[model samples]
Each structure stands twice: as C-alpha cells, then as structure tokens.
Target: SGFLGFVALNSEFPQVNPAGSVLLPLLTGLFGAPVLLISAFSNSSNIPRQERRLAFPSVFAALKGSIAGFFVSIFPGISSGVATVVSSIGERSDRGYIVTMSSANTANAILCFFMLIAAGRTRSGASDALKSLNLVPSFQEIAILSIFSGIVAFLLTIFFGLLIAEKIEKIDGRKLSLSVLVFLTAIVLLLTGLQGLAILLSAIPIGLSTHFLGVRRINCMGCLMVPVMIWYTG
Candidate 1:
C-alpha cells in the first residue's frame, strides 16, 4: 500500500488498473445472470399488481431532504447518508426510505456542484483530478452535465426498477442471494487485491454477528462519520 504512495510522492507513479473492472461485471453477473437463470428454472404464476401506498408525504421528504442537503454541503466529509438520517425523522415504509435516501444523495451531489463553483473547493477525488488537469467546468457545462445525469438516473432507477419488478416474481430468492454473494466476493478480490480481500473476509464474521444479534447496521457507518465529527469539532 505504502509503496504506491511513496513512489507517487516525489514523482508521478505509473498508473495501473486491475485486470477487470468490478462494478459492471458484478452487477451483470450478480443481478442479470441470476435473474435470467432463476427465471429459466422457476415456474411462475402471473401475480396481480398490489396497490402500494405512499407511507409519507413526498413534499415533507423533499423539503427536509433539501434542508439536510444544504447543511451537509457546507461541511466537508459529511455524507448523503447523514442527510438521509436527518430527513427521515418519522416512521417510513420501504418506498419512503428509498425515495428519501435517493433524493438526499441526488440533492447532495447537485449542491456539491454549486458549492464547488462558489467556493472553488474539490469535494471529491474526481473533481480534484479534473482540477489537476485544468478541466474545471463552467456553470453552463455543469448544467448540461446535470441534465444528462438526471436523464440517466431516471432511466436506470425507474426504467430498470420496473423491469426488475416484472421479473422479480420469477426469481428464486435464495439462489439470487447466493449468486450475489459469490459475485461480490470475486469482485472485491479482483478490485482490491489480497489484503483488501482478506479484510473483507475477516469482516464477514462481524457482519454476520451484527445480523444475528439484531444490531442496527447504521452503527457501522460510524467508522467514517465519527472521525468526520471529530475533525469538524477539533
């Protein structure tokens, strides 16, 4: 780990990529392949669509999310997950949680773009890389990028979600879970190398313990959030 950092300290180190990218392959293999496999094997009955209720007011979620997004945007190292917690003060259903958290993440990113333009700050490594290359975008460029981003997000989340919902009834849950678990394991090993892979394997017991002990997984997020709180306070 330090070898790469050391070589890059005084001079640029040779950049190398892992043999295979993790995300697209993982998603397609973990989700797509399993869905197809399960559908091919399982006999399905046509399920009637159930009426889903909106458990919380969309306006309330949006308003609170906007406020939390603005708050987090002002502070470095705070994440959209924190905003999600802040906005979800009341009891919410699964849909409510999804919409609120997704909205918070999108809102936070949009706010970061504004914050960057206003304060000349690089909130992410991608932004820093672009700055390093003198490719800082103008407001017009950001606007166009944002529009395209919104379209892509809409297509992926809504359109793809609809497709998933349609085929979800045909998929075997246990098979799908096992497929995802194996796919994810391979992905971590490939992308992160042996040490990172070892850490992930080591953490499996802790993760299982939490699930068995019925602990809220939010506590795990303290790993990053706790240090950020200390950083800002100090």
Candidate 2:
C-alpha cells in the first residue's frame, strides 16, 4: 500500500517543477516530523546530566570503519548503512559500534570527493549537487577543503556538544519538539509553498504510523525508491 501510494505520487511529481519540491517536504514529514511529533507527545524525562568524559574506540575499529566506508564509496549500489552493518560484524560493545558507524559515515563523506574526482561521477548527494551547479573542484582543492572543513566541524561539534550537554537537562523536550515542527513546516512552506505543505501534512500521519505500528522507519524510503524503480523500469 505504501508502494502504491508512492506510485500515485509520481503523477504529482511532474507538476512540482523540480523533484525536490516533493522530496524535500515529503521526506521531512515522512522522517523528520514524526520524530518531533513523538518527542512532543511522549512522556520522556529531561535528559540526564552528561559526564564530561570521552570514550575513544580502539584504533582497529576506526580502521575497519574506514575500509568499509571506502568500499561503499567505490560501489554505486552500496549505502553507508549497509557498509556500517557489514563492518559491524563481531562487534560486542555498543560504544564500539557507535564509533564504527560514525567513523564509516565520516570517512564515506570525505572519500566520496576523491571518488568523484577519480571517476567523474557523483557518489553522494553533495557531489551530485556540486556537479549540477558546475562547481566541481580540483583534486588538491577538494583534499585541502575537506581536511580543513573536517577540522572545523570537529571543533564545532565538540564545542556545541559540551555546551548542549551542560544545558540539556534544563530544556523542555516537548516545547523544543513543537518549535522544531513549526520551524520545519515554515521552511517547507517557504521553499515549496502550499503544495509542499499539503504533501508534508499528508506524510506526517504515515510517518507516525511507522513508529506506532512497530514497523521500520527505513521502509519510508520506498517513497523515493519506488518512484526511481518505476522511472528506470519504464
């Protein structure tokens, strides 16, 4: 039924000008909005005070993730999710798994640029957007910018993480969730107008059901994947 709904949406897709007109709002509602909704309505307690301690994973775990990420970068069909799952074989600790997954995602982001330069192909959305905008950079430029931005991002993450940790317990989760939902709706309206809002409104219920119905959220990906399958098969 979800797949059928996705098929029905294909007719509406062409009317939207760019596919992103549908995708941006639909995905936000399908994936993002439900999360906020749950947080808004749930009886979740305030976050616990976080300890200012770091738990670094073993070097071997990082190396394994990097290798898995590189493997995913070189392949067209393989996704980072799949790579992370595969790389997590024999993982015994939750912390190690978290570290491995994070490492794989980070490595995949950085290595994808090298893949783009080497193959003149877009392996990720960022690379695809760069290609679309005709803003592809040189190999050296990519290397330098990637490293520099990575360092900045790392620093910012640590800074903000500590800041958030200190104040997280004081935050009202429900209010924050409601605020985010409003902001998300506003952005959708701004970017795609009434039509996108309609799409977003339609998707929120479906997204909510995936959680309440005990179904996997990943199935929501069919909203995009099914359409792609139809396009290619046709």
Candidate 3:
C-alpha cells in the first residue's frame, strides 16, 4: 500500500521539464538525505577507524556481478541496485558483497556504452546524453575507451580509499553528514527552485519511514519503478 501510494503520488507530478528532472531531488530525498539524517542523529554516528589494508575479493563474486550487470544492461526498467542484489545471491561475506557491487557498477557502466552503440538503447544518463548528441562511438573505440577508463578508475579508487582511510578518523561523522544534507538541499533548490524543494521535503519523510519501519531500503525504489512500469505497460 505504501509503495502504491508513492507510485500514485509520483504519477500525478510531471517528472521532467526544461528546468530539470525531478530525479535529482527525488533520489536525493530517498537515498541521500535520509542516510545523512540518520547518521547525523544516530548515537553510533561516529565512524570507526577503517583498516588501510587492501584485499582482493572472490573471483566468483565478481563473475556473478559481471553477469548480472550484462543482463541488466540488456533490459530496460532494471536498475543497478537490483543487479547488485541479484549478484549477491548466496554471498555470505561482507567483502563479497562489496566487491560484487563494485564490479556490477563497473560492468553496468561499460555495458551501457556497448548497449548504446549496438541497440541504440540508453541504459544510463551518460548514454542518453551521447545519444542526444549523436556521439555514439564505434564498438572497437568504446571497448578501448572502457578498458583505459577502467584501469584509471581502479587506480584512482585505491588512492582515494587509502587517503580517506588515513583521514577518516579525524573527521566528525555527524557534522559531515549534516553538511552533506545541507549541500544536497542547496543543490536541489538551485536546480529546481521552490517546487523541487517542496518535493524534497515531501519525499524525505517517506525515505525516513523505511528506516523506522525496518523495511528494506530498496522498497523506496517504487518511486522510479512504479512510474516506469506504468509508462511501459499503460
């Protein structure tokens, strides 16, 4: 019923316009702001000193994630979060989920480029932009670019992970979360103005209900899923 109501509510509003898409505010409210608010107010808000050691995840987990991402990219109405969940099936370790999700994200991005070129389908915003600009590259070119970008991104991730681990203990987690919440609000206001602000404020409570009700966070995806389902099936 909650999901249905959320879907109904979103259906009543125009999700996009020349100004901006409601996605920026809706996603921020559902995923970003709620987490920040929870972290800001939680008694255990202080972040622990993370270990600086690097470890390789299971090859099987990565393979599963890659497969899931490939399948997700071939279809519309499926999201990376859903693919991550699918990839984590039977995984018991936290490290497995971590690696699997990361790999899924990587594979999804790379495959979206391929999907854009091969099927003219825009699986991501970047692909949509490329399609709009008529900038789709050849298969060979995209593959080479994907490989190069992946290597660079992997190196950057390690560097930033280690750097953040070194300085994380000194950062105030609550204050950081609150700062992010403020920044997110400002961005929504700047991009979407008062109407977007109103949507953000409305959506935040719904996002919070997921936490308080002990429901899966993924259920909040109804905002997108329901609307898409309606559009495709209507």
The candidate scoring highest on lDDT is 3
By lDDT rank, best first, the candidates go 3, 2, 1
* Model 3 spans with C-alpha error above 4 angstroms: 1-19, 129-141
TM-score of 1: 0.61
Q: For model 3, how does the per-residue alpha-carbon lDDT over 1-234 read when each residue is reduced to its tens digit?
A: 235334434645442344454566777787789999999999988889899898887999999999998898888756677789889989999999998998898889889999988888877756765775678899999889988988998899899999999889889999999999999898788766777777788788989999999987778777766766776787
How well is each residue in 1-234 modelled by candidate 2, as lDDT tens digits? 256346445645433332235556777887799999898888873566777765557788888888899898887634566568778899999878987898888888877878888898666656755665667788899889978988998889788988888888888888988899999898778766787787788888889998889986767766755665666689
Candidate 1, which ten residues in sequence have the lowest lDDT sum?
1-10
In model 3, how large is the Cα lDDT of residue 210?
Answer: 92
Top candidate on TM-score is 3
Task: Report the C-alpha lDDT of model 1 over 1-234, residue by residue, as the tens digit.
Answer: 122212222232222233322222322332244344444445652344544332444776777777887787777756576788888779367666666777787778777776777788754434544555567678888888989989998768666666667666666555665567677666656654554344444444443444456765444444334545555688
Task: Give the TM-score ranking, best first.
Answer: 3, 2, 1
- lDDT of the structure predicted as candidate 3: 0.80
Q: What lDDT would candidate 2 get against the real structure?
A: 0.75
RMSD of each: 7.8, 3.6, 3.2
Name the lDDT value of residue 72 in candidate 2. Answer: 85
Query: Which scores higher on lDDT, 1 or 2?
Result: 2
- Per-candidate TM-scores read 0.61, 0.76, 0.84
